[model samples]
Target: MSLLRAGIVGCGAIFPMHAASVAASGAARLVAVCDPDANKLESASQLYGCAGYDRLEEMLERERLDVLHLCTPHYLHPPQAILAAGCGIHVLTEKPMCIASADGEAMIEACRRHGVQLGVIFQNRYNPGARLIREALDDGSLGAIRGARCSVLWSRSDEYYAESGWRGTWSKEGGGVLINQSIHTLDLMRWFMDAEVSRVEAQLANRRHPGIEVEDTAEGLIAFDNGVNALFYVTTAYSHDAPVEIELHGEKGTAKLTADQAVVTYQDGTVISRDRLPQDAMDYGGGAKSYWGVSHFKQIQDFYRSVSRGEAPVIDGREALKTSRMIEAIYRAGRTREPVLL
Candidate 1:
């Protein structure tokens, strides 16, 4: 089988991961990369031995790519995706999907009109540990999930945000921690519960990084349509960096997963725990725990299979809209200091 030809936009911090994934997948090849910065393009091209262009149009015209991965800043997601779709290329955009619900809708419409597949990079949902929890939910082992909580209490130094031009700015990066850092956890929470958030009440604060234009911390209460309630807390200001933890409470049992380990306790006196059973690592800045980079590869391979089989991608554009809508509702709730209904 011929490998899928992939082109990537925005050769920034996350570009290497996508490049590595394409290289490792064997199902796809990084044919080209596009970035506004000549230096970034040159460096990434040299590193990956792929062609690079300073503009998307040039790359598209030159490469005839089978897939276009939008690894750009938050604000660029919608436009880049639309353009990619228009060029008759499937799109794989990094999440938050888009900065707003309207933009996400626009991207979806563009893809539908062009008969192109659009997927968001919510690789956390692809982790084996996460999939196990989902399996438990499906089998009713978690039984009538009552409530859930996800905490993305990770810390980011000022230098981390300073590494890029669009790091902490609202116009470029959308919101702060909630959009950039906590979005994966938020997506995971929604996926694990398999519920749509019907309402949200939130409070956002610039508690630590006053230098940034967006919230550094946000807390929200989410009510799912299935009568499941969840509390979400995300902050980049924690003094001690903590792993993102998601806990699901059920009538028969409760499952807690922190850093890719699953612990479950049941009403019938069954307690089981599983450790790092070949799960994708979170994209924390290099460490023993880093797994985000490789997971992108897994998702891309899945996308290729979906394309070949003429099936919907695992995290299709429409499915991705749910996460973006919830995010918008949270922001609205935070701004209005009241519950926002879906």
Candidate 2:
């Protein structure tokens, strides 16, 4: 098959991973990159041997791209995605897809109208352990899932937030722990449970980070459509960062998965345990790290495949809207100090 031509926007911290993936993937080639910062664009251009532009319009005009990767700030996601879709370019956006559900819907609608594919980066779903667990739940190995818990206790210092102007702002990064850091685990939670949240009650605060306008910690109770309840706790203020852990309780047994391990215990004395392989680059300018270095690559490859085969991406724009809705509901719940129905 002919390689798909791809362009990347916002050559920030995550751009290298995407560039590397594109360079290594058989299905796509990194043709152009755009960033407002000249230094970032030059660096990416040097490293990836691709043309770089300081503006999206220039890049779009110069390159014949099959896919456009939006790696910009949280707020730029919707507009950039829509722009790409309008230009007849398929889009692969970073997670949290968009800050607002309305924005997500607009992007999806624009893509649909333009006949372009829209995919979001939820690479954790591509993990072997995640797949195995999902398959097991689908086959009723754990029976009816009744309850679940998701905890993402990670740390990001003040310096981390200071690295980018949009890191901790509500207008830029959207929200703190929930929208920026916890969205991955939150997406995983929704994926694993295979249910939409019916309602949520959340408490959020800027506990540790002093200058940030958004929450550094968030604790919430989520009720899913299947009558399963879940408790979500996310914080970037922990003194010692810990791995995210998820526990799912079912009618017949319970399954527990830490950042690196998965364990299942059945009611009939059957116990299974396996090491959960990391499927994405977890380290984003931090001491904490993850193993899935090629996750973005996997996502891009899958997109190229989908385009070639005329199939849908794993995390399409519509599927991503659910995550955005859940996020908005959580923030609303925090503000109202009461449960918000989704």
Q: Each prediction's Cα lDDT score? A: 0.85, 0.85
List pairs with backbone clashes in candidate 2: 279-292, 280-292, 281-292
**Which segments of model 2 are wrong by more than 4 Å?**
276-290
lDDT (C-alpha) at residue 227 in model 2:
96
- Model 1, 67-148: lDDT tens digits are 9999899999999899888999999888878988899999999999998899899987766667778888899887899999
Each model's TM-score? 0.94, 0.95
Give lDDT for model 2: 0.85
Scanning candidate 2 in windows of ten residues, the lowest lDDT window is: 280-289
